[model samples]
Target: MKVSFTYDKKQVLQALRYHFLSRKEIRLMIILVNVFALGSAFLFYFKKILPLAFLVGSFLWFILMLSFWFFLPGMVYRRATTFKDHFIMTFDPDSFSVGNERGSRSYPWKAVSNFLETPHFFHLYFDSRSFFLVPKDSFSNSDEIYQMRHMLKEKIKN
Candidate 1:
């Protein structure tokens, strides 16, 4: 199967956010920050801690959420030239290829460590920090998307 696609800014940002949140470390960090914030609030309400403690916790929580939701994605999007170009992607039984104006590259199934399905894209990961984003809208329909998902599942073990 094959498809052609160009990234939309909003969709790309959403995908980026999805990608980050999917990571174990990011999720842990968010949970930890929220826990601390809640703890601080609890203590403050019980008059067991000074107001400064609660204020600091709330500030940290807000900054962490803002960074994840906006700052990080914006910085990544701006620095990435990949999303700015059009791409032609072809998937075979054993491998896939991605082609753009600059060039084309092909990789075997082993090249992909895993894949993640977000609302708008298939986040194909080479590793935790590197990935290719294939927009779901590029597929002809739901059938193609299903086929791709099945193929990825069979090809990538983890």
Candidate 2:
């Protein structure tokens, strides 16, 4: 099967957020910060901690969220030229290939370590830090998307 598409900036940014939060370390950090912020709030309410400490905790939580939700995704989107390019992707029994105006590359099933499905894209991960997003909007119909999902499950290991 084959599909061709370009990334939507808004959707891609959301997908990037999903990818980042999916990481164990990032999720853990967010959880820890949230817990700290809640603790600070409780302590401040009961006069167990000073106002300054509570404010600091709140500020840290805000910064962490702002960085992940806006800064990192914006920075990544600007830096990666791939998201701006139109792409053609093909899937077959043995391999998959992706091509853009500049060039094309093909890889066997083993090249993909895992895949993740979000609302808008199929994130094909080569490793922990690298991946390609295939937009669901590129497919002709839901059936094609289902086929792709099934194929990825069979081709790659989680």
Pick the TM-score winner: 2
TM-score of 2: 0.99
Q: Compose the digit string of candidate 2's lDDT tens values, residues 1-158.
A: 98999999999999999999999999999999999999999999999999999999999999999999999999999999999899999899999999999999999999999899999999999999999999999999999999999999999989
lDDT of each: 0.96, 0.96
The alpha-carbon RMSD values of the candidates against the true structure, listed in the order shown, are 0.7, 0.6
Model 2 misses residue 130 by how many Å? 0.6
Give the C-alpha miss distance for residue 145 in model 1, angstroms: 0.8
Off by over 4 Å in 1: none
Backbone clashes counted, model 2: 0
Model 1 Cα lDDT, one tens digit per residue, 59-81 = 99999999999999999999999
For every model shown, what is its TM-score relative to the native structure? Answer: 0.98, 0.99
* Model 1: pairs clashing at backbone N, Cα or C within 3 Å: none
